[model samples]
Target: MSVFAVEYVYAADTEEGRDTHRAAHREWLKGFVNEGRLLASGPYADGSGALLLFTAGSEAALLEELKQDPFNMQNFVSGLRVTEWKPVTGAFADYA
Candidate 1:
């Protein structure tokens, strides 16, 4: 599996929508966490976006999984980027 850095850019004026769906979003994440696919995830302090680290067999597989995210399903995420990441050092370096 490869590690990926997933960046989610929230749509403008969607704070309320996010709040409404936050519980479902977290519930969805728990399944991945239990499966060891999600490494870490959190919103930016500025609330513009969020960063999520995940492990998947391929980018396509990862995207398929992300399509099910409550935020994405609700259109709260306006932009998304998935990049393969190699953690050369730090807590994630073991993935390297």
Candidate 2:
């Protein structure tokens, strides 16, 4: 499996839409966390975005899974960026 960093950027106007779907979004993420596909995830301190760390067999598979996120389905995401990550040190170093 490869680690990936997924960033979600939200516009100011999306707050209301995000709030409406927050419960479903978190619930979807909870399943991945329980299955160990999701390592870490949370909103940015500035409330403009969120970061999600995940492990998947391939980028295609990762994005396929991400399509299930309510935030994406509900169109609450203003921008989405996905990158394969290499952790050379710290807690995630083992995954490198």
Candidate 3:
């Protein structure tokens, strides 16, 4: 398994709109995390965006899974970046 980092940029108008879909969005994400597809994910605190760590065979596979998010479908995410990474010195490094 390889790690993929996904950063989501929120559109101003849709940023605040996330509340309306928060429940469903979390529900959609729960299955992925429970299955270990998602390692960790959360907002950046500044609220401009969020970060997600996924373990997948490739970036393209990760992208396809991300497309299923309720938030993404609603266009709450204005931009994104996906990169494969290596974690060698942290709790994440030992992730199964």
- What is each predicted model's overall lDDT from 0 to 1? 0.96, 0.90, 0.87
The top-ranked prediction according to lDDT is 1
Q: Which residues of candidate 1, in runs, are more than 4 Å off?
A: none
In model 2, the runs with Cα more than 4 Å from the true position are none
Candidate No. with top TM-score: 1
- lDDT score for residue 79 of model 3: 94
lDDT of 3 by residue, 1-96 (tens): 888889999878775579999898889878878988788999999999899988998888888888989999999999999988788888788753
Write candidate 2's Cα lDDT for 1-96 as tens digits. 889999999865888889889999999999998998888999999999999999889999988988889999877887989999999988887776
User: Which candidate would rank higher by TM-score, 1 or 2?
Assistant: 1
RMSD of each: 0.6, 1.0, 1.4
Q: Give per-model TM-scores.
A: 0.97, 0.93, 0.92
Comparing candidate 1 with candidate 2, which one achieves the higher lDDT?
Answer: 1
RMSD of 1: 0.6
